[model samples]
Target: MNGTVTELTVPTPEQVARAPKVVLHDHLDGGLRPATILELAREVGHDLPADTAESLARWFAESADSGSLERYLETFDHTVAVMQSAPALTRVAREFVEDLVADGVVYAEVRYAPEQHVEAGLSLDDVVAAVQQGFDEAVAAAETPIVVRQLLTAMRHQARSREIAELAVAWRDRGVAGFDIAGAEAGFPPTRHLDAFEYLQRENSHFTIHAGEAFGLPSIWQALQWCGADRLGHGVRIVDDIEVAEDGTVTLGRLAQYVRDRRVPLELCPASNVQTGAATSIAEHPIGLLTRLRFRVTVNTDNRLMSNTSMTKEMTALVEAFGYTLDDLRWFTINAMKSAFLPFDERLAIIDEVIKPGYAALAAEGV
Candidate 1:
C-alpha cells in the first residue's frame, strides 16, 4: 500500500493460486496424499500411529514441527514404508504430479532416494521406471499440461552415494532430470560424497546438494566449492554470512557475496525452514533480502505433506508477509523456471509461453 494505487493492490489467494509456479525442491516421498498413505499402509500391513487419514495427516504436521531437521525427517518413514512397491511408487508419483498441477505448478522437479524404496524387493531401476511412468501418465491425464521431472537423491550419511550417482546418470535421458544428496547435514557433510559429485561432473551431469538448512555457512561453503552443486537446496544458512546494521547498511561476507555475484539459485522453502528451525518466520526469511538484492531467490515446498503446504500456500504466505504483488510473484516463478535442470529451450518455452501468459492474464484481472 506504499506505492502507486496500481502497485499497491495485493493479489488475493485465489489469484495467487492461478499464477503459474515452478518448483525445484519438492520431495516425491514427502508429498503423498493422506488417504493414499492409509490405503497403502493397510494393504502392506504397516502399522501407523494414527488410524484415520485426518489424524495421520495431523500427526505428520505436528511431528514435523519439532524444530529439528532430523526429527522432521523421521516422519518420512511412514510415507516411504508404503512406497516400496512398483504400484505404490507409481501411484504416489502420479498423484503427486496431479496435486501439483492442481496447485498451479506448471513445472516441478521431484526428488527422492531410490535406495530407500528397494526394501520390498524392487530393483533401483524398477523404482525409477515406475516413478517415471507415473509422471508420464499424470502429465497425459492433467486437465492442464504440466512438466514433471525427477531428481534422484542419495542419503548423505549412507555409503551409496556413488551407486546412486551412477543410477542418476544411467537414467538421465529417461525422465531423470538431475541428482541430489539429501539427509541430515550437521554430522554428515557433502564432502563425504566427493567421489559421487566428481563422477557426475565428469559425466557432464547436473546435481544439487542439501546444505545450509540445519547446518551453517560452512555446510553451504562445502556444497558449492567442494562438490560443485548446481543449486543449493534450502540455502537459508547463507543468511549467516550477511550482516545488517540498525541504520539499514548491509555487508556481505566473502561467501555470501560470491553466491549473489554468481547468481547461485537458493531453493528456499520458507515454511519448511521454520518447521525445521532454519528460519524463525516468513517475514524474517532471507528470501526477502536476497530478492531485493537480485540474488536469484526462488520459493519452494521442500516437503508438502510434512509442512502441510502447496505452491499456492507457499506463495500466499509470502504475499501476506512481504506484500508481494503479481510482479514479485512472477519474478520468483521465472527464477525457478530458469534454474530448472531441463534444457534451455524447454525452460525458455515454459517461461515465455506458459508462465508469462498466465501471470499476464491474472494482472489484467486486477485481483
Candidate 2:
C-alpha cells in the first residue's frame, strides 16, 4: 500500500511451490526442456550452437536477457525449426504439461501457431491433433493432474491470420480453448487481423492478442477497441497509462480505466518483461501497482527456457522483488484461472476444489 513497503516480507520458495498455480500465456514452442531440445536437434541434424544440454539451456537464458526484442525473438527460430513434425509437436506438448504439473500448476493453456509447425508436410489438423494427444498423455500421467488447453496462435506478421482463426474455431471444444496472435506487436497491429477477429467474433470465440508488451498504449487500445480481445497477452505496457502523483494518489487514463473497469484480464509476466526490456526490473514492474489497483493481473513465464522461469520461479521473483505473500500468490493464481478460456463451470470447479483448498492449506499453516 505504501508504494513498495520498506519492510517487505517475501515468501519462501517452499511456500510458493506448495501453492496451486495456473498459467494462461505460456508458449508451447518456447517451453521445451533443454535436454529434449538437444536430443531433438541432434536427431534432426539441426546442429545446435551448444554441444551439451546444460550449455544449450544456459545459452537460451543468456541470449534472452539481451534487452533487445528482435534478438530475443530470433531464439525461437531454432525451437520452431525442430518442431515441424507431429511427433515433435506431441513430445514437446507432453513435456510442457509435465513440466507445468511439476511446477504445481493446476491448470495451464499452452499456445503455439499451427501454421508454424506444419512445415513437415503436416496439415493444420495434424499439428493440433498431435499436440492434443501429447497433452492427453501428460495429463493422465500427472500426479494430482492438471488441465491443459491449447490456444491456437496466428503469427501477427503473417498473412494467415484468418485461416488460423478458422483452425482455432474448428478445434474448439476438442482441445483448443481460444485463439491468439503473437509476434512483433509494434508495427503489426492487432487491427491488421480485423477479418480474423471479426470471424472469431461471429463464432462467439474467445481470443487474446500479443499487445502492450514491447509496444505502448496504442497497441493495447487497438487490441481492446478495434479487435475486441477478451484478454491481453502480456498487457504489461498498459502501465504506460497509469500516472502516480507525488502525494501518492494515482490516476488512470481512459483506456486504463476501461481495461480495469471492464475487468479485461492483463496477462503480466514480470521476469519476461525485464528480459524483453518491457520493464527495467521486477521491482520497478507495474505488476504490484496494477494488482494493488485491483486490475485482473496474473503472472506467467512467456518462455520457460529463455526466461529460465517456471510458474514457481515467477512467484518467487514476485515475492523477492515486490514482497508478495502467500495471499498475494493465491490472488495471482486465481486471477489466471479466472481469465482462462475454459467454460465457466470447469473454471469454477478448479477454483473451488483445487485452488481454494490448496491456498487454504497454507493459510492453516500460518502462511
Candidate 3:
C-alpha cells in the first residue's frame, strides 16, 4: 500500500499577522487608501470611477486582476492623478508607512517614480523631499519600531532613467535607499537604460530592475548580465529556465543556476504575480519550487491596493498555499532584510535585534 499523505499544519491568520515581515518591492503610488484617494480626488477636482471607498477599492482589485500586466498597470492612473502636489505626496507617503506598521512590516523599501508625481509642476527634488517628510513623520509617530526607506524608480519607457539614477544617489544618505526601472517589460528592455545602470554601478549604488514578469528569459538575462542589477523585481519568470522531471528530480539551466548560486534576490510578489498573469495562482506559484530549491526568495506585495493585499495577507496566503510555518516566514523576512540596499550594518542590526527575536517569541507561543 502507498504511504498516506499527512496534512500540513498552517499558521493561523492572527499568528501570521503577528509575525514580523520585511518587504523590498512595494510601490508607493500603488498602496494609497481608497478613502484617501476619494478625499484627494475631491480636492484636486479629479473624477473617479467609484464614489465610495469600498467600491473604489473593489474597482482597483477587480481592474488589476485582468491577467494582463499592461491592463493591471492602467489602474494607477487614478492614483497617480491625485498625487501631484507636495502636500498630497507627503500625506500619501506618511500614510503608506503607517499602514506598513499596522501590517507588521518591520522594514520596508517603498518605491515610486518621482517623475510621475511631477506632472503638477513639482521638481524631482521637491517630490523626494515631500515624500521623505512623510516617512519621517510616520516613523516618529509609530508605536512599534519600524524602518522605511525609499527607492526612486524610473519608467522603463521613458528617457529620464539617468536623471532618476542621479536623484537616487544624491538622496541616498538622506532617506533614499536605491534606484529601479519599472514599466511594461516586453518592448523596452533593461539594456535600454544601460547608461543609467552603468552610472549607478560606477558610483557603487544598488538598483533592482523590473524584469521576468511581462517578458521572459531574455529580459532577465539583460537585467542581470548587461545592466548589473542588484536584484530582480517580480522575477517569477526565471522558472522558465528550470525543468522538473517525473521522478521529482530538478534541472536548472545556466541562468537559473547562476541566479541560485550567486544568491541574486528574487523579489517575488505572489498575489501581484497572479494579477499580472506571471503565475497561475498562489498554490502553483514558482515561489513554491524556488523556496524548495533554496533560491534566494523573498515574499512581497508589489502593489498593496491593486493586489488587495498586505504583507500579512501575502504571508497568510502563502501559509495556506504552501503550509509555511513561522520559521519559513522568518526565513523569507531575513532574506529580504539581507537583500535590502541599506547599509550592511543597519540590515544586520534589524535581523539580529528585531526579526530573529520577533520570530522566536512567536514560535514560543506555538504560532
Candidate 4:
C-alpha cells in the first residue's frame, strides 16, 4: 500500500443542514406547516382530509406520491382553500420564511398565485400586500438574516396571466422578485401565455416556466424558444433529448445543447419530480447526468409539504444518491444564487460575502 492516506469527505446530515442554501422555486401555498394548516383550516371551517398534524402531513405526502402530475397537483386544493383571507395569507407567508431560515436557506423566492387567494373577496393587490407584510415581518424577526422574495405565478389553466403579470411588475420594486407560469403542462402550453411572457420581457423582468416536469421536451422548448423563460422550473425532461450509446458515449440533441450552451438554469426538485413521475428515483434522476454535463443545475424544493422536503433534505438526498461532497453542495448553492431573480450586485454580494464564506467555514470544519 502507498504511504499516502486518502480520507473521504462526505458531508454529514448536520453539515448539510448547516450549509447555506439558495432555493429559486419554492411555492408559498405548497409549504405551510401541517399544524398551521390545521389551525387555519379550523378558523376558516375548511374540512381537511386528516385531523391531526401527523396524519395531515402523511396524507399530503401520500397523496402527492401518485405517479401522475394531475393527481399530485390535486393535493394543493386543501392548502389553497385555507389561504383565501388576508390574515391567513400573512400568517402562512410569515411562517414560510421562518421555515426557510430553519432549513439554512439564506435566499429564497417563494411563489404563489394571487388569483387563487382572491376567492375570499380579496383583490389581487390585497393578496400581494398581505403576503408581503408577512414576509417583511418574518425577515425582520429572523435571527439568521434571510432574504425572501415573491414570484407571482399565473395559473396556466386560467386566463389571468396578463393581469397577474402586471401585478408582478407593479410590485417588483417592493418585494416581488419575478413572475412565473405554473399548473398542469399537458393541454396548456407556455405558448398559451405568450402575451404575458412578452409583456414581462418588455418590462425587463425575469421569469421561469414550469416546464419539463409533467410534460416532455416540447414543453421545455415552448417555455424557452417561444415564451423566453429566464429559467426552467423542473426542466427534467431535457434528458429526453440526450442519448447514451452502448459504450456510454453521450449525445445531446440540438435543444439540449442550446439549453446547456446558454447556461439556462434548471430548477430541479428531485423528490417532487419522483412524486410527479418525472423520474423514477433520486438515483435515476437526470440531475446526475445534467450536473455532469455542466447544465447549470440548481436544486429546489417545489413543494415542501407535498414532497416532504426542504433545502437541507434535498441536498442530503442528492449526497446519498450521488455521493455529493461539500464541494458539490457548494456548487449547487452558488449556481442557485447566480440564477436568482434578485439584482446582479445583490446576488454577487450573497455569493461573495455569504455563500462562499459559509461553505469555506464548513470545509474548515472538515465536514
Ten residues in sequence with the least summed lDDT for candidate 1: 1-10
Off by over 4 Å in 3: 1-10, 68-71
Candidate 4 weakest lDDT stretch, 10 residues: 1-10
Per-residue alpha-carbon lDDT of candidate 4 for residues 49-155, written as tens digits (9 for 90 to 100)? 99999999998998898666566667788999999999999999999999999999999999999999988899999999999999999999999989999999999
Q: Per-residue lDDT of 1-367 in model 3, one digit per residue for the tens?
A: 0111212234689978888899999999999999999999999999999999999999899899876656666789999999999999999999999999999999999999999998989999999999999999999999999999999999999999999999999999999999999988989999999999999999999999999987999999999999999999989999999999999999999999999999999999999988777788899999999999999999999999999999999999998898887778888999999999989999999999999888777766652
Off by over 4 Å in 2: 1-10
- Local distance difference test, candidate 2: 0.88
Taken over the whole model, the C-alpha lDDT of each candidate is 0.92, 0.88, 0.92, 0.92
Pitting candidate 1 against candidate 2, the one with the higher TM-score is 1
Worst 10 residues of 3 by lDDT: 1-10
* Residue pair clashes in candidate 4: none
Q: Write the per-residue lDDT of candidate 1 for residues 165-278, one digit (tens) a residue.
A: 999999998999999999889899999999999999999999999999989999999999999999999998898899999998999999999999998999999999888767
Q: Supply the global lDDT for candidate 1.
A: 0.92
Stretches > 4 Å off in candidate 4: 1-8, 68-71
Q: What lDDT, from 0 to 1, does candidate 3 have?
A: 0.92
Clashes of each: 0, 0, 0, 0
TM-score, candidate 4, is: 0.97
